[model samples]
Target: MSSPPDPEDLTARARIRDAAMRHFGEHGFEKATIRGIAETAGVSSGLVRHHFGSKEALHAACDEYVLRTVRKLNEETWAAIKEGDLAKASATRRPSGRYHRYVARSLIDGGASELFDEMVGMSEAWFTGFVKGDGEPDVPVRDRAAVVTAWGLAIPILFEHLSRAFGVDLSTPEGDIRLASALLDIYSHPMMSPEEAAAARAGLERAARRSTTEGTST
Candidate 1:
């Protein structure tokens, strides 16, 4: 009798939720404001509050949205991996690389940085778990390392693709892939002795200094 609670109102709420996600993704939780989101979504602040109750609730909703997206992407990747299609799996799973462009666009176009970071962090944790074999003790370390290396490689490549997709020349795709490969190599190595760890740290420090110096000169 109430006209199904107004489909238009439901659509407006969905728009507000999407706008809030973009704002939170771009600005982060501490900075994204309810009024700002309402304004961006072309809704009154009171209506936004009426729908979400509070900023915290809105943020929780944004997190939920991001998690759902990541889950969908992961499922796609898993399907590809199960079929022994590494290329397809990488294509599906490399959120940071390919998906970042959409995220950046969302931030630039819709102002959703906080949601983007949440998604990034969630994806990183997922990949970390994949690398660690989800607590399966019987899973061989070598196999885990291989998967981790592949993940690392995939991230940078995907990022490169995303950069291109978004029309941002932040870094070359090749560079990203190379950096990811190096990081994977480090992670795949056997656990170092304390002395070895200390030496590795010192070497890393030197490399960092060298990089800083080169950056300054350039």
Candidate 2:
């Protein structure tokens, strides 16, 4: 079967959208302008407006584009994992890196809660598939997935901090490898033992129950 069309085409409209994404990521929604995005895309402001109406409308288009791209990348990753193809899964980093900064910034930009929630919902479905037993999981899939999604979002959002700590520019491949190496060390060494984790979970549950009770009592 033929492969699906790549979304990052060289068309004028795609260029404008990509430029707008980068601008919005770097400058945020309030500061980024249609004219600036047009200049970056090598198009006229009028053309940008012609293609996307207004800045708000253009941003909405970007939201749609990024979500679609992320969904595609997520599927590729899961497929690679299922096939035990480490090389293929690792390759996703390159294409995804191009948009990583934008996604990280976009999440915190106003009105992106829908995007964040959609990502959580997407991960929840995937986590549910990993449930091996018919019995209840120790943690609910939605809760677990939401936390994991937030953690994933945090990496790019904290890129500058990570880069400064490592003394390397993480946007580059070498710095990425350095950070990944440290992360490997971290993953290899679990911070908490199973006993500690069980204890923590119990404490958290108690705290949650107490908070809920207090809220309902008022």
Candidate 3:
């Protein structure tokens, strides 16, 4: 009789998933070949096909794995926030800048661009649902918008920080966190008026223009 799958087999599978994730992150979906992944995982290419079926299935699994990690991190952050552990919450929050870098790199490295869009759409849907809660006990639209905005700003900042921790180039997490905190402070100011918002918009526009000019020149 054939032996049952051993713990070593499970560990090997997990290693394959990790190798796939790193390869995909570095080279992207389209360019990340199954043979390369198998090589990285120290397994036969045939084994990879046997486990994941196809490149598309492997891509889906990778996306699902990343999203799952993000969701778990977010949950941990929320729990810390609820428990009034600000430091722990900050540490546990998903790094937004890192995520943005990952997406940008994936696009540049010929990764599956469609997968990126799908991930973002999924995130938006999840965020909307979380903000809306039960429609039966409807929240004020303004309050919901505020919550959504806060979350939107926070997530990217967390990604930035994680990217730095992981040694990825692009914006540092500390910088993103500082910027996000400033924005949050401005938004939460007791005396924040329309004038302040207008000024902030103007400043943001100037920054964008400067960045565009620099990019063009380079």
Candidate 4:
């Protein structure tokens, strides 16, 4: 007869999974190793394999964990904004902020496309509701906006060098608040009036037409 699952086995597996996610986020999937993750988790390499079967499977679990964390963050952001408190809704680096750093690095390393897509999909669903006016932008515009938003959020973590140049340690709470305030200021203010925006678009269209005509003539 088969024996039942051990609670200790479950605990060890959870520890391994958490450690693998941290390693994958920090060093990336290619550079992270089963032995390294096992060491970080304080478990044996054999235990890791027994629990996850392979490094690829462990990476998959890490991806799912990232996705779930993102979804929870999204929900919390929405909740705070619904209460009319944007400041409260702003993304804070978590207590175990290593996960956040890992995510940022993973995106920069090009190993988190699935996470990016899931976020964009979630944003599209939320923003689609706001497109009710006569001048509502289409899917392509929304896609580009979402990508820009993702980059804006990722750049600070992805390129810590830039933060260093600015004399700000973004890993600290003070620096995070400084950056958040600046971003909030920009987002709250209109960059241009509608008339100014329309004029800018017209100028761009004219330039585009000229370029096309010049190409055709050549």
Report lDDT per candidate.
0.61, 0.80, 0.61, 0.71
Give, for candidate 3, the lowest lDDT window spanning 10 residues: 130-139
Ranking by lDDT: 2, 4, 1, 3
Candidate 2 TM-score versus the reference: 0.81
Q: How close is every model to the real structure, measured as TM-score?
A: 0.45, 0.81, 0.53, 0.75
lDDT of 2 by residue, 31-142 (tens): 9999899999999999999999999999999888878777777787678768877456555554657777777777776556767898898888776774254357687788
TM-score comparison, 1 vs 4, better candidate:
4
Candidate 3 per-residue lDDT, tens place, 1-218, comes to 11233354367676777778667767777788989999999999999998889888886776666565565666666567568775666655434333454444555556644544444554454455543332342344455455554455344435556556555533544554554465458655646466785698789999999999999999
Query: Best candidate per TM-score, number?
Result: 2
**Number of the top lDDT candidate:** 2
Model 4: lDDT equals 0.71
lDDT of 2 at 218: 100
Off by over 4 Å in 4: 1-10, 91-96, 129-135, 138-141, 162-168, 193-196, 211-218
Predicted structure 1: lDDT: 0.61
